[model samples]
Target chain A: MQVQAASSSRSAQLPPNDPPGGTHRRAPEKLPRSRRRLAPYGFLLPFLIFFLAIFLVPIGYAIYISFFSTHVSGLGLGPSQTTTAFAGFSNYRQAITNPSFYQGVERVLGFGIVQVPVMLIFATILALVLDSTAARLQRFFRLAFFLPYAIPGVIAAILWSFLYLPGVSPVAGILHSLHFGTVNFLGSHSILWSIANIVTWEYTGFNMLIIYAGLQAIPQSLYEAARLDGASDFQIALRVKLPMIGSSIILTTVFSIIGTLQLFSEPEILRAVTTNISTSYTPNLLAYTAAFSENNTNLAAAIAVLLALGTFILSFGFLRLVQRRSMGVSL
Target chain B: MTLTTPKTPRPPTSEPKPVRYDAKGNRKQRWDRRSVLTTAVLFVVTVYFISPAYWLLISSSKGPSTLYNSAGFWFAKFQFGKNISGLFSYDGGIFSRWLLNTVLYAGVGAILATLLAAAAGYALAKYEFKGREAIFWTILSGVLVPGTALALPLYLLMSKVHLTNTYWSVLIPSIVSPFGVYLARIYATGSIPTEIIEAGRVDGASEFRIFRTISLRIMSPALVTIFLFQFVAIWNNFFLPLVMLSNQKLYPVTLGLYSWDNQYGQAPQLISYVVTGALVSVIPLVIAFLSLQRFWRSGLTAGSIRI
Candidate 1:
């Protein structure tokens, strides 16, 4: 099977060489032409159906509903008294003016700015260490680091919550024994970082694997040449390996940024233990509460639209910034 | 992010080449400052990452009374068996049902997704038709859109069709991975040959048959990688199920555990159950990832590298 595949693939590399079947075909090409035209559509049908229904239509609907509002007259206790109208961006106006929504956005931005770098840095370092010559038991270490990633985010949050609570937390117990005073992991100020720690622990290994793959793809001859140039391992890592894996780092950063904006499962699970995390602690959480708990789908739709727009702009802007910086370096 | 140059032929099956490192250097034995630092860092980070899993193991074995009083990292009593039994027996074995529900959703959803993506990606790679680039880019753009932004809207859409709170609500959305489609296209283009398809066509094989017998066999390695990714994704998914499923019977393990954790205050016994449940739910996927490391590494490379 492998031999046949390899030989056929070799023939494919040749340009339009000798017609298919090479004179073994006595039939007209009409049927083949028609079938070829329709085949791709058949293959694509299932994926496109779900894509349109779940992805595109929802996006369009969110944008559509964001312009409308549901109003109630008098006591407004009955569904009969409720009426929906085209309020013309009134939901957007309301969302913009709401401090809770803005605060959620602000909190997420702060979280991303601090968290993305720390996580990616640790990932890069771990990848470099594992890739280095001194590394031993690479498989075991790699598996150990990545094991946490296999745990679901909600589960990780729960496991870590036990470690965060004062009475059950071994880490807190250790800190108390060391006379560091009692530290509240779920405090209002510390909860975000607590969540950050969960995100970091869950993802650092996964990102390390990505970067390590990048490191693997690098030609070993480059390392040899750098070593011959009197560069130490540290120097080679900094000057050679680090610069070569820039794209990988940037790819992880983009993903981390996007992940930061959609923070939901961790905080939502942690909300059970801590009073610090409100329903509006993050933008996605804010949208969730607005739509479900508060029964304001229109406002939720507006927040979702804005959140999507913010994500697109931030990622696109980061890409542009990186592009411009690289182009400048070349110039 | 280097693309495969035209001159460098890919392996026949497109399985990622085994990891290779130079063995000529005898310098590994040297205990330099950098090596010490690197090893120490690895040790520290490993402990940091594994400490919680270790704690969960120890804590799950303790009864509720000893859970808080005993040292958090050490075992107090052997209640692991009891805790696990309680976890399963609670609410008419609802936790077991949630585990099975997770398997059904993730397994079925990922299988369907891999087939759909493989077919579509193969088509996109081999076919020359109108609006091809337009369709491909539009699908690729779906990768950029955050799922959180879409979850609410998708729920609203599902409710409109009376599909919300059903298995379809979660399974249907989980299967549409734009990123999977992207990876499948790249893999197909690099691995499959046009001449083979042409010859199959000349032999009067239907396109679908050709895909099932020929293309699918050749793409098996890539397919496994794609399926693993989608499986892990759907397995780890919490938000979608949380929003779509209101029925405890329908809850995936993640959401079920969250519900129990929420009720931890009233039913303090649930702490052991939740801890045990978390450990049970995590085992299968962790084993899957560790064993399938090679395939996923290639997947990560394929995703990161520009093709």
Candidate 2:
């Protein structure tokens, strides 16, 4: 009992650490007939090892690397003259103050301020619609809406990018024929929307499925009872359906926030097709350029660490908000 | 919180009060209105949703020279055969190689990752041992961390181990899925009962054997769910592969199309190949989604609501 208490407290302090001394755990009774308890730690061994190496260790390494910088002595004529030193917050300071980094944040903020809500609204509406129907075609819509999400992000971006390319695009051909005036969708003025449309298309369906699942889980008798009370369809959706699925809407919101904070693939891949996207089109993109293009590994690490921190803070805060607002859970 | 007592009848001695919030009648009017509006809206939205892809189908057919000059949103001609010929014959058929590489990357990577995740998930849900919660949280946290955050660190790790540019670099990291494990844990919890395992144990089955025979068979739905998740996750992955491999031979479809599009300003013909390639790329994705539609019903949020 004391060991269990200590382990729980220890988990609070060392979030990544297994409870110390491993003595607290008792196996569940054995499967198929034996009274002997099966050990969970043994079963969990595969995940722990993989998680430690890839997720935990790398996060530690990144934080460690973020504090240092390489200094070149004299005119920096030779490679041997350069030395790595602990630079405290200088790398972080540079990253925070950098023009490229700030611009990436602004651009993404602009994109997120528009994209996240639009996608969520579309998803929530579709889900609510699908929920009302036990109709024959509802399943088809349910599957069709989510089909886009199965397409890989890079492939979706690639597909959309292909459609955006002027000479090779059928849409462009159609616009030309209609005399609608072909403007560059991938151009600087419109690339953000181009990127947003790809994301909205890809994720809207997945979100709809999540929201629909939430809606469907509501007991069928509730709808029948609502009918008994002479409630309108809008009344049930607003009063019961929406409030019941409030938790899921919040989950999607948190996910969208995390995604927006770390936006990379769409903008990064789109960079090749358009001159509008810069080395700093998004925070991840900027961190990438700092690391690979500028060869400022420490600064790059600092930016990456910062970006991760931003994501953690945003998601944690969002989760807390969702919990408090929707279910009153103190996350 | 309905005061539902399916097996129990009203007690003769005393009657319990109905739950205050159980008057679901208040909700009926809204349900009726929502039903009519929702159906009509879905039909219109569904058409809007698929129009772009329809445009893609129509566009990839037109010949390269007239691609920009012709109407693209609607059909002019079917160049499906010619487009493939152009795609395959271009630059000694580099596009075909990229497509092959993609199949290897997404196909193998997703399958392996799914297995790893399923095994890990089963452990978390079914076993009760030391550090079980710790291990579960370690994985759960992974789901929230963006894949972008891992790209640079993973690149450094792969470089240090001399795995960069090899398939292993991309494939190894892919195996540790926080979300996949989360899904698996949820699935395992409901699907694999302790009683069955206890029964298996009474029959003298080993722990792994119990999992293999009883747990695995029961948890097949979750496995398919995890497979689709990993498959979609891996197939769409760009950053890690971009960071790890520079060799053209190692390029997946996404990266290959990206390289082709990057040079479209010079060689306009590359745009046609990229266009054709993009259209075909979505084919497998649509197929993956279609097959996995049923499993998508059980989501992470819904997992919490299962009871």
Candidate 3:
């Protein structure tokens, strides 16, 4: 089977050189030109159908709903009495002006700024270590590092929640034993950091794997060349390896930034244990609160649209900035 | 990422070739001080990474009261079996039901997604069609748009169609992975030679048949990579289901556990159940990750380097 597969693949690779088969010539002539041209579309049909239904349609609906609001008259108790009206940019304005939404945005920005770099640095370090010459048990360590990533985010949050709980946390127990006054990870001031910790723990290894893969792609000749120039391992890593994996680092950063904006599960799960996290703790959470808790679907739709736009801008903007910087450096 | 590169026809084979200094370099500087330092630092980081999971394992095996009273790290009374039984029997076996629901969502959804993505990616990779770039860009944009941002809109849209509480709500959305499509396209382009598809065509094989028999067989490793990605993604998904599903029966394990953890204040015993359930929920994924590490690692490399 393997031989047949391999030989067929080789034949497939040399199609232009091969003489046209008698049956194939007849088959194409029998099929309409348009139908032949449409074969790719036929292949793409399934993905496009789901993509339209699940992605494009919802985005369209969100944009449509973002422009309208239901105005309730009198007691506002009945769906019949509440009439939908065009609100133009009012919903967007409201979303922009809402203090909670801004707070959520600020919080996410803060989280991303600090957390992304820390996580990426850790990931870079781990990736470097794993890719190092002297690294022992590389497979075991790689798996161990990436094991948390295999665990679902919610489960990671739950597991870490137990670790963060005062009486339940082993770290906290050790801290208490050392006579450090009880530290509250779930406290309002620390909860964001706590959430950052969970996010970091869940994602660092996955990012490490990406960076490590990038490291793997680096030519050994480059390392030998650097070593020949009397560069230490650290110098080689900092100058050559780090610069080489710049795109991967940027990619991981962009992903981490986008992920930070979508921070819901950790905060949402943490909300159960602590009063620090409100329903509107993050933009996504705020949008959820508006849609479900407040029953303001229009406002929620506006928030979602705005958030999506923000995400697109931020992600693309970062990409563009990195591209320009790299170009500038190269030039 | 663009699907322009068609080089590197076999990625898995490229792995061992890159390690040019694996034996010679290692033996030259075996147990050097720098190597020892690097090893020490990595060991510390690995310990930090594993500690919480280690804590979860030990903590879950403790009795409810002992969880709070005992040293969080130590195995205080082996209640692993007891916890498992308690977790299974909890709330009329709701935990088991949640696990099944998760499997249904992640497993089936991933399989269907892999197939769809494979098809789409193969099309994008192999075909020269009008508006292909436009379609690719549109889907690429979908990759950047965070799913959390879409959850509200999807909820509203699903409710408009009266499918909000149904399995289709989660299942439908979970399968439309733009990244999967992106990866598939890259993999198809990199690994599967277009000449083969042309050869299959010249052999009077239908395009679908060519894909099924020739392209798919060659693309199996990449497809597994795509499947594992989509599987882990759908498995880890929390917000989409949390919004679409209020019905406990339809809740994925993540959402189900969150809801239970919310009520932990009222019934503290639920804490142990949550821990045990969290541990249980992670087992399948751990197994999957370990088993498919090669495919996933290659997939990651393919995604990064190709881009």
Candidate 4:
């Protein structure tokens, strides 16, 4: 408002420049201000367009789709005999009751139960090792650890999927050579572990990088002071480093949790390699199967919506809980 | 970053103080032993991480028929080229097409993502507008929403718009990265100064021109950082492509290899192909990492100082 009046009054009192200068600058200078305000919207327009058309619309569509179900009339071949309509809670009810979905959750939970801790522990140890004094070629080791993370999940899964095969696996080859025999790495009982290992191998370096960043942020003077107090290196680490880097730990942990829930690539690839992983191995895999194989897009949408809600409740609630425990510290 | 070392005071001290280190030769020897042990542990840790990748590199050169005959960790007769060529020739060179498709999906998509994120971030950082922070926060909130959770909805929308089965399905959603935006904003806030803009305005440079000539040059390093991150991310992405695509022709290397891997029982030769494919997939990523690693030093120092 102030800008508008100042420009207009200044233009009214304008001292026009020489004859060759055909234009006054004050009014036009203000013209750019109004446009500059609109500039942000212009900058945001692309993201907004894609966001609404893709993200916003789809979420709304998921909600609407979740409430609908197909009505297949008797003699269901005819176009008139089949239709989709509202079916409140039915799809959700089905998903919850389905033993396959339950099994997937249990399997993944079991996978997480075993895997996440091992990953965190390995990452923490690797981070600590990298941070340790007298550790030679720190950058070299950092690169070595982080190198695997650069491999795409699909590529990593493919690489590991082959190694799990009995006929082609070098593990099997070596075992046979040593007469130690071979174990089915991707068999039903072991497929969970196989997938877990793939995930760990692909992501441990990533988590280590984050954890090491947190480790490197620790103040050197604190460590020196702790040493002056006659504390052992181990004691200083346990008593000082861990507690100070707590927020970063929470950050990595939450990211890992989300990654675990979204587990797809490794298991999906392993599915082709092993008979053990059925179509409904994970909620995501289940949704994919329902949509593609079963031709139940509505059910797939329903599961997706429910899964999204589950993710929000779990991820946000867990993070919030951590935030509260940390007395308002955020990741 | 703080490392917990015992009280080894380094400051120039004028006052005489009782020092434990004068009589602590045993402790010094113990510390040396501890350092050796730590190096051994680090070596072991490095080996553990490299085992599988090393195993893949060694196996890729082996003939399919001899894969089971060869030991796990040793190289066989050099057949890397043969395996790669066999992979291409097997099934009408679909593997090569998949590799190309992956390059397209990750490369193009990541470039677009980096640009959009930088633009959005730069605007958010430099501009003072109505609801500026609201928009930034909205984008930041997306950081919590996992890509897998969003994949199905995005797939459904694309199919509804008849955009599915096209490159748009995989590429469109890859461009909106909350993390990239977050990083860009931080980088912009720290690196770009308000005085540069005021000076540009004083010189009669247009705002957009100022952004182009002055701001982008200053933000160049941040742009590269975001690009590298998004490149790695999209390259590694699997869930979105999986949910959005079904046509094998459209499959990225990850999906393509998976399909081939599934058929290992029918054709054991694909094992060699898959191994070679894995080795090929990692080369570009390693190169990108090494080239961009120097940029990460600034990022690390930024981490320590929180500036």
Pairs of colliding residues, candidate 4: A216-B1, A217-B1, A217-B2, A218-B1, A218-B2, A219-B2, A227-B6, A227-B7, A228-B7
> What DockQ does each prediction reach against the true complex?
0.49, 0.31, 0.52, 0.32
TM-score of 1: 0.91
**Model 2: residues >4 Å from true position, as ranges?**
A1-38, A72-81, A133-136, A162-189, A328-331, B1-40, B299-307
Per-residue lDDT of B251 in model 2: 90
**Top-lDDT structure, candidate number:** 1
lDDT of 4 by residue, B261-299 (tens): 667788878878887888887787777785555454344
**Model 2 residue A300 lDDT score:** 78
For residues A1-331, what per-residue lDDT tens digits would candidate 2 score against the true structure? 3323433443354323232344343333322112223345556667678778878878888888889998767685555476899999999899888888888888887888899999999899878766653222565677668767766777677777767876766656667779998767877778899899889998998888778767756776777788779987678888879877776777678778878888888887777767898888898988888888987778877887888888788778777766666554432
Order the candidate numbers by lDDT, best to worst: 1, 3, 2, 4
How much DockQ does model 3 earn?
A: 0.52
Kept native contacts, as fractions per model, are 0.67, 0.50, 0.73, 0.46
Query: Per-residue lDDT of B182-254 in model 2, one digit per residue for the tens?
Result: 7787777766667787556434456788888888887776776777777777777788888888898889888
Model 4 chain A poorest 10 in a row by lDDT: A18-27
Per-residue C-alpha lDDT of model 1 across residues B153-203, encoded as one tens digit per residue: 999988999999999999999899888888888777777887787667656
> lDDT of each model, Cα atoms only?
0.83, 0.73, 0.82, 0.72
Interface RMSD of 3: 5.7
List interface RMSDs for the candidates, in order.
5.4, 7.4, 5.7, 6.2
Sliding window of 10 residues with minimal summed lDDT for model 3 chain A: A24-33
Candidate 3, pairs of clashing residues: A12-B195, A12-B196
Worst 10 residues of 1 chain A by lDDT: A1-10
